[model samples]
Target: MALKILSGCINCDMCEPECPNQAISMGEKIYEINPDLCTECVGFYDKPTCISVCPIDVIITDPAHIESKESLLEKFKHLVNTDRI
Candidate 1:
């Protein structure tokens, strides 16, 4: 599933570097994740790095936008703009 930043975000800016897809960005008052670019770190890491480092547990799975692992992999491939993934 693609992730979303909840209101719990502390805006620490830590998650930005952790996202391989460059999906996370600074919003008006908090960090936001671009669902179109997020692959939940499927093709790049063993786990979602943003979730691993977010101190406030702000990043979370978007249940409304859930996708399978295979789909996530496809997303990762697209985000990286490569077929090698």
Candidate 2:
């Protein structure tokens, strides 16, 4: 699943740069993760970098956009190369 930054975020700016897919961005009030670009770090690392670096641990799996690990890897490949199958 994609990760969501909860409202508990303290805007510490620790999670944004940690995303391998560049999915995290500064929102009006907190950091936001783009579901389209998020892969839970499946293809890039053993765990989500954003979650690891978050000072407050506000990141949570997005139940609304649940996806399998295999699918997340596929998405990561697609993101890096659209021509890839």
Candidate 3:
């Protein structure tokens, strides 16, 4: 599944760069995560970096965009030229 930035976001700009897929961006008043680009760092890292650095724990899973692990791994490979999954 993809991720979403909840209302609790502090806009501290900590989670932006941590996202390998470049899914997070500044919105009108807060940061937003692009579900199309978010792969939960499945292929890039062991865990989601945005969630790791978010001080307010604003990053949360998008239950609506439920995707299987295989799909996420494929999406990650399409984003970055990585051989591992």
Name the best candidate (by TM-score).
2
Q: Residue-wise lDDT of candidate 3 within 31-60, one digit each (tens)?
A: 999998999999878989998998888789
Question: How far in Å is the alpha carbon of 58 misplaced in model 3?
Answer: 1.4
Between 2 and 3, whose lDDT is larger?
2
lDDT of 1 by residue, 13-37 (tens): 8999989888899988888888888
Per-residue lDDT over 1-85 for candidate 2, one digit per residue giving the tens place of the 0 to 100 score = 9999999999998888889889999998888999999999988899999989988788999999999998999999899896354
Q: Considering every candidate listed, which one attains the maximal lDDT?
A: 2
Worst 10 residues of 3 by lDDT: 76-85
| Deviation of model 2 at 42, angstroms | 1.2
Model 3, runs deviating above 4 Å: 81-85
lDDT scores in order: 0.88, 0.91, 0.88
Question: In order, how many clashes per candidate?
Answer: 0, 0, 0
